[model samples]
Target: MVDRLEQSKALASDVRLTILTWLKTPALHFPHQVTGDPAEIGVCVTLLADTLRISQPTVSRHLEVLRRAGFLRVRRIGRWSFFARDEITLSDYAEWLRDTL
Candidate 1:
């Protein structure tokens, strides 16, 4: 289970929110990847960095937070990392919001 406080903190930033929003519909937000499917395998870290106009390390930091919060899942292919949203967790969080708020 995800820590509610951590999940809330993960959603606190505008940049993080944008990242989640883009990831929610990667095909619409990101370019066609060469290796894996965006929806299935996830978006590449390099692609996310380029799209966000941020350093890879910076993007990694944000991704780490979301990962810890259980909002994202990562897949390693060679030396590259791909990220996708945890839809079940997202739905749970939404339901949590509806119940709690």
Candidate 2:
């Protein structure tokens, strides 16, 4: 199970929230990817970094936080890493918030 506090902390950042929003609709927010489908395998860290105008390492750090919080699903394609929203966990978290709050 995902730790509620950790998940809350992950969502506390504006940048992290934006990243989640972008991942929610990657096709609209991101361009076509060659290696993997944006909606399937997820968006590349480099692409996210370019779009966010931040360093790749910085993006990776944010992604790591989300991943730890169970908000992200990661895929490794050769030398690259991709990230997408964990829909089930997201939905569960939303339901949890609705019930708890």
Global lDDT of each candidate: 0.92, 0.93
Residue 40 of model 2 has an lDDT of 81
The parts of candidate 1 lying over 4 Å away from their true place are none
Estimate TM-scores for all models: 0.95, 0.95
Give the Cα-based TM-score of candidate 2 against the true structure.
0.95
Model 2: pairs clashing at backbone N, Cα or C within 3 Å: none
Q: What is the C-alpha RMSD of each candidate to the true structure, in Å?
A: 1.0, 0.9
